[model samples]
Target: MNGSLRTILAASIAAMAMTGVARAADVPIVPYVEPVPVGGWYLRGYIGMSNQQLGKLDNVLFTPGTVEFLDSGGFDAAPIYGIGVGYEFNEWFRADLTGEYRGKASFTALDRYDFNGDNIWDGSNDYSANKYEWLLMANAYVDLGTWWGITPYVGGGIGASRNTISNFQDINTPNGGVAYAPSASKWNFAWALHAGAGWEVTQNVTVDLGYRYVDLGDGETGDIVGYNGLNTVNNPMIFDSLTSHDVHLGVRYAFQ
Candidate 1:
């Protein structure tokens, strides 16, 4: 072959080989994404702590011609458990239906009454009273995503509650001291409002903390009269309205 032709052919072959190598390098061998399932229905179970307080009431009992007294401090703390069904609307928002059970919480109070206008005291005056309550609820929520690993949310619901009063003891009084014993249980309609946030510890598991305020309607406390071997006096009374402020910490699992 002529020198000039040989040199041109050799240079052409070298360039073609270089181009093949460059094309192969530009083609990616692995994709750059992860697979995640986004929307679905999920069920969550939770348990946490709660604190409750009861509101004040007047003329608790309609005891004619006498004054009634109730202990103002009816606050308690206990464990709470619940289950919920939820729907994920997107990455930022979701809604849920929840119901919770709170164990029995109780407190004691004293009730006293004046029977007659007699200057000489003679009546059964003192009695001991006990109170307790339970709650059920449902709510909706908004997930605020995450900062480090924490997610925040808010929700509300309506439910029913039961209040009970028992264990009455008669107190000594002048006017031949009257013996009075009273106990009753009542169910009432109620509602709850709550706001809280949680932390995702893993892809499918979360730890949540929150606060809720609830209102349980008023109940009736019947007239008090003598029971067993005690003097009798009938005075009407009503149970006051109830409320609670609860702080809770719990765990949740998401099916992804």
Candidate 2:
């Protein structure tokens, strides 16, 4: 019985030694772990051209008892700039707060009229105006990860704009002598919508291109002329509306 037990113990020790050697040979030399990117804060800036227009303003107020005039058509491309702050919620989504400023845009018009068909009453008229707008917005975006070192994203936002308008007109004699005076000033309030895509240049910097549309409320008008140029003019009325289109490019930074 003792000799049989000794033989079994020897066989078990030999089997365990061979299994350890085989396992070591099968083990790989290198080790690896799946990757995960860290997330935190980010910022960006952009500039682009804007296609701006003011809707038709018809029969705008003028001198009392005098015929109303239509505001001339105006359009232009202006520079636009923006900045933003963002919080990355995950690998694919982020929320941001942004602000943009658009440079001054201006337009003008001129008209000639025959007052009572009298040569002495004939006069030439003019209209001139300018506007400046600023917006504050909030938006959410989806990051499509990276492809060929370029990261593309799309998003939208709602915001408000402060607008100013300056309207002026001049009346002159047939001989070019000044007959009526020039009128000009500023007005404000508009709302806006924005959307765009951006390219990530690095983990910390980004470049963006986008577009926005703004709707400025109607215009407010008051009497411009008086009888004998002394008494106040009644029948004051407000006319006109303002709107604009904007294209922009910007850069941003991310903080981990």
The local lDDT score (0 to 100) that residue 66 gets in candidate 1 is 62
**Error of model 2, residue 90, in angstroms:** 2.8
State TM-scores per candidate. Answer: 0.70, 0.68
Q: Report the Cα lDDT for residue 228, model 1.
A: 51
* Native-to-model Cα distance after best TM-score fit, residue 62 in candidate 2, in Å: 7.8
Which pairs, if any, clash in model 2?
A: 43-252, 43-253, 44-251, 44-252, 45-250, 45-251, 46-249, 46-250, 47-249
Tens-place lDDT per residue, model 2, 1-256, is 6999999999999999999999999998887886646578887777777777656545433434343344465745667777778888887788888777777666665555555645443555564555556666777777777776566666555655555444433444354543222232334455566666567677667676667676655543334443235423343223356766777777767785
Residue 9 in model 1: lDDT: 100
lDDT of the candidates, in the order given = 0.66, 0.61
lDDT of 1 at 126: 49
The digit string of per-residue lDDT tens for model 1 on 37-126 reads 665676777776657665653443435556454455454566777778777777677767776776555554444456564533333344
Best by lDDT: 1
lDDT of 2: 0.61
What value does the lDDT take at residue 188 in candidate 1? 84
